[model samples]
Target: TQRYAITIKRSRSDINDEIKNMTLGCNRSGYYRNRLNLTENSRHRQTSSKLLNCLFKLFASRCNNTWSFEVRNSEHNYQPSKDMSVNRMAAAGSCPHQILSTIHLNDLSLMAISKTIYNELYSIRQERLDSRTPIQALLNELQGSDFEFEYQ
Candidate 1:
């Protein structure tokens, strides 16, 4: 199975303010290391890993409010998962520590850990945008009003 990560490279932008570019890459597309780090004196256990250091990736750029995408590599060493959505849920929680046990027992990547954190932040951002607070409702109603006020 395969997973992916979304990475963004941004700079101070006069128009968009940020988000200069973005990338999507296979989560397993990197150096392979024996995470077990088994010492000579330590008891050995059979361990297996699915990581293949695949190089599949895509890139995107923004220009004048338009976005363009390009694929850097079209092939993967590992077979694609039958259900990509299942991989999306692989790191669905807010805390990396919550999955530490899984990481120790398996060959999970750091990209999956970061995906969990990003999911949390994205959920929070969506919640705030969809908030039903009375003040927020009032602001929504006043969005195109003729008055402007400074707000943090």
Candidate 2:
């Protein structure tokens, strides 16, 4: 029962080249903060975080048409959650054809595939956000214009 979250991602590629690297850490890898400020009063109840500051991590790299995985700080600070298993392959299997078409046949590692899919998805989301929201679109337009405004 191991679950990991991407802690870092790096990619360097031009139209003709691609390289990717990522670090995955135990899902519970951060300090749990019950409150942002002790003095703040909230109508909603404060929720507890599952973070245990776990140190376990896996580094995955793809370079020179090769893929490598390395582990560091290999101890988990908490017990694995029974119902928290994730099916990474299933998720990857559902990647849209547009994203799948950008991947090279040699770059078949789960990390590689996921990186490509996520990058495309992120760009699509950003484009949608920039284009669909009237306020955001207006602000972007204003930023490029000589128009001036004041706020308090």
Candidate 3:
């Protein structure tokens, strides 16, 4: 039940641009690469990146004590039944909120994989939002803290 926040060092504009370029690069690299479903709009890209960043930080922190973090993006098809029910209730003028399952960080390998996936998706989302020139290199920059979970 630990809470974590992701503080981006760069400005929002810069991060948005970076993510936009990364998304385009990913799309161009492979037509069927389904790692991220990025739109070609700056606004959508910005929102999606921000959302992903927040989720990643939250999951990473939770993973330190658990094994994984379950993502329940309303935009994605992974919403839990309770969430769907809550949305339905809200649409019917009720304020019911559905609870989804929590993802745990059970092992080092799972944590690493989760971190990698988060980083990749975050970069791609940011690039697509910024519309900046795309880079040709793989975006693999990871913080040293990413491995700290192994020791803990």
Candidate 4:
């Protein structure tokens, strides 16, 4: 006599819902496993924040239009409303110290990168100041008057 065995497999949507439910349960729990999961989520959040910061810096340097540094659709839903306000104040040249304080340095590695970039910008500003040549003057000299200005 021969016997047949049956196997069961969960659907993709079912698996996804299972994961979402598990994450929600872990978030509510205070066990070590839950803490570890939370730590991993925080790390992911930090990485995303750093990426957004770098992208914003690159875009701000190249594009004329303003870019809002808001993180949407994040796993943890960590928003930086206070940071945005501080950045706005800094842009207006009102609060310098608060601007530095507003930046979130959750990951040490990304924090180092942020510090390095900030130092480089500071050095460039210092050189500009020492040479008594403003950045606008240098840029104007580099690009001749033949370049037409476009108004949107």
Q: Which residue segments of model 1 deviate by more than 4 Å? A: 1-17, 34-50, 84-152
Q: Which of 2 and 3 is ahead in TM-score?
A: 2
Give per-residue lDDT, candidate 1, residue 76: 76
Worst 10 residues of 3 by lDDT: 21-30
lDDT of 1 by residue, 56-145 (tens): 778877787798889888787765432223223434742445443454445433333345545655665566667677577667767768
lDDT of 3: 0.28
Give lDDT for model 4.
0.34
RMSD in Å for all candidates: 10.4, 16.6, 21.7, 20.2
Error of 4 at 64 (Å): 45
Candidate 4 TM-score over all chains jointly: 0.19
Query: Ranking under TM-score, best-scoring first?
Result: 2, 1, 4, 3
lDDT of 3 at 31: 24
Off by over 4 Å in 4: 1-90, 105-132, 135-152
- Model 1 TM-score, all chains together: 0.40
Better of 3 and 4 by TM-score: 4
> TM-scores of all models?
0.40, 0.41, 0.15, 0.19
Q: What does candidate 2 score on TM?
A: 0.41
User: Pairs clashing in candidate 2?
Assistant: none
Local distance difference test, each candidate:
0.56, 0.57, 0.28, 0.34
139, model 1: CA deviation in Å? 28
